[model samples]
Target: MKIPEARGPVSAGLLDLLSGQPGADPAALANLHELVTVQLRAAGDIIEDEDFQLALFCLYELHYGGLEDVDDHWEWNPGLLGIRQLIEAPFEECLRSAALGCTTETRLPPEGTLSSDDVAAILFGLAAQESGPSMSRYVAKKATLEQLREFLIHKSIYQLKEADPHTWAIPRLTGRAKAALVEIQADEYGGGRPDRMHSALFARTMRGLGLEDHFGAYVDSVPAISLAAVNMMSLFGLNRRLRGAIAGHLAIYEMTSSRPNQLYGQGFRRHGFGAEVTGYFDEHVEADAVHEQIAGRDLAGGLVEAEPGLLGDVIFGATAVLAIDGRLSSLIMDAWDNSRSSLRAAVPAGL
Candidate 1:
């Protein structure tokens, strides 16, 4: 959880400021903004830009659980927030574009033309119809021990804090939507048993794999595409205006979760691991089946019914999850196919 090595000038400057180094300069904020803006414009694929994505990840981290040993004051620093906005503008645009592309081929019912139940039905139907490359399928059928470990490393970025990003929506919603979210979140939190929490279950999975179980332990080893996947959730969750998007993100996340989790459990069993090693996925298989219904109907659908304007954002958010996740899956599969590690080069021990 120590400050990660800077990936570029913006991250370097931000780190320096956080570390309380005398060399840190406020002027770097403007430089960082210009650098990110120019890079975002010139880049053909922003999601794959390690430096830009990592820098933005660091910026967003300040608002989450801040980096270990970094000053809390940096969270509210005007200069840093200003620079973050510069990075986020294009990132948001890219998300919208990706979402649009994913859903354009589908025939959606006209906006406001459907009841909450109908909207939920449409979302569930669309999720059911989706036919993308299944990372879980590959893991279940063909992954080696090393490959499974690598998969855990990649997943830890989000799983270690599972459901946290979506928690930000609690204050932004009301009535049935709010109640639905709380119900789902309660289960994610293990229903009053701290040890049963999904995050805790994932930690056990990491330990079972002989991997580090601490939060952020693998951050230094993951690539930007991996980080981007989690960062997108944080982005949607943290913005009040993006509440619908976050809800949709969670709905799609649950709807698509059950089957893959089953595959994941099968994969672990294929490797001779017992329930202890497969508990996280095993839990999700059953939990998400029910959660998908609540999320699609009561949560996402109710939210849009309460506020019709958020319908587009809801669809946009759900689609973004699929889009980014597709990219991450493709990256991992490509690397494994080529006999390369999908992670960044591992950090040396005791660094």
Candidate 2:
């Protein structure tokens, strides 16, 4: 991935420091940390803060495909990790706080008595609750060609590398939970067929719409809320302690995906797009219907049954996704409702 344009002082400093060899300038690292501390203190909502979100996004990217022309060693630089934690701590707290409003302890069964089937029922209920604005409904019923393209741009950030973040939990899990995640992920990776891989399918959709298909191609085009959505996945997946959260995240994601994807395919088809342009959504419409069952019943539910103690984090993960994604949908729909671009800057239309 190319080094994204800096969104603020922290991102700018991060990019600048990453341009050099790791540990080459200790003073620069120190200054960067100090900058993060000061900015974090001054910031209101870290999740929606452009500078912090972009900075954290870039930092997490190093663990994935990495930044272009940046030092690979910086991926584990202690100072950089410290800076990421500075942002992550508050951001995660905010997510937990928001999730509180979306979930309740009464939703889950008593600690040691919760069965896998019972946990699955609770997760399905959480996924079923009607929340804020609905992006899928708008895309299906009213989005124009330009709005459709902008929607693809926002999704491109994570869809281009679909199933990766949650894959981190494979080693952290065992028995039924482990097998379930692998099963779901196998289908996500097209069951070993590279062309049919979800990311590859999504790339085809992007090209059909005359947009860039590469990962991170549109990182600069989205807003903080967009980045926060993906960042939340990375946060849960990367931390071993949050393994339950990642499981819950995947469960909710699968549970919620099928119907919207059906509507998404409908929207694209309504615009006269062909299979190549709508296949990604069509694929999800079918795949997630099955995936939702396995994820909710075997993956998340199985995990909670095995650990029991992680029940709270499991619910936290599921609700956090709804909270963040609800805000993202509202942001997009509100912009479109007002006749504006949902992206940070409008893209060229007439593709």
Candidate 3:
């Protein structure tokens, strides 16, 4: 992806800065920050605010794949980092507040330290809760061809680069946590066979649907909550301060992945897709089922036992995903139920 269509004044200005020479203009940066500040003050439901979420999404994108026209030097530019912190503050506060409001088992052990098994059990219990409508069951039974395509488009924003956001936590971990993460990541990366990589499998799924398979292909079409869900991962992963939260995020992610993916594959088969099309989801069913065990017991549990302080953050990470993803599923299901598109607008496939 080249720089996408700017969603607002802030994004336009920020894109201009990134596309320009490194250290090009301080005045322009100041103006972008000013626009962002003004927008944040009046921005209702920041999670649903297109401009705010888009601007923040672009800010995080710098750390991932810098825009095609963007100079790499901008990734480390202090002004940009400062602007990143500006939006991140509120986004994080919103997430933390939402996590606090979630009803689930996040209780810590009485001894103030989790055993390898203790941490796993807490995460498992959290994953097993029914917090919202089941998008998986809906896809398994009722989704149309167009609706399935729409679902893929929404997911393409992240699935095309699956496992990357969480990979940021590898170096931040040590001992069993570190080893366990590497074990999980190896499978996600296809364990030495590129075709088997989760991202590659997902891309094949997109191609099976006759949709674009490149990263950021349908980003402009997805809604704010979609962006917000992925942004939450980047937020937890990129911040060293939130290392525990990132670990927790991955545990919940794996624990919840298998069944939904199975249903997703079933939905595609309902449309007459073969193994090539459903491979990605089918692969996850087995992979995540096994991963949930290692992640819960060894990765998450070991981390808490090694560093007791992260237990709260670990649970926060798990519940935060539950809360955020529940909202995202609700957004998709409600739109589909009403015969409306979940995207910000109707975008033709393969755009």
Best by lDDT: 2
lDDT of 1 by residue, 1-351 (tens): 568888876677667667773225656656666776676677766677777788878877877777888777778787777777777777788888877656634466677765688768767765765535689999999998889989999999899989999999999999999999999999999999999999999999988988888778888799888888887888898889999999999999999999999999999899999989999999999999999999999999999888888888888888888888888888889888888888887733532
Ten contiguous residues minimizing lDDT sum, candidate 3: 100-109
Error of 2 at 32 (Å): 0.5
Q: For every model shown, what is its TM-score relative to the native structure?
A: 0.94, 0.97, 0.97
Clashes of each: 0, 0, 0
* Candidate 3 steric clashes: 0
Q: What is every candidate's alpha-carbon RMSD to the true fold?
A: 2.3, 1.4, 1.4
- Which residue pairs show backbone clashes in model 2? none
Error of 2 at 209 (Å): 0.5
lDDT, candidate 2, equals 0.91
The model with the greatest TM-score is 2
Q: Residue 170 in candidate 2 has what lDDT?
A: 98
Considering TM-score, which of the candidate structures 1 and 3 is the better prediction for this target? 3
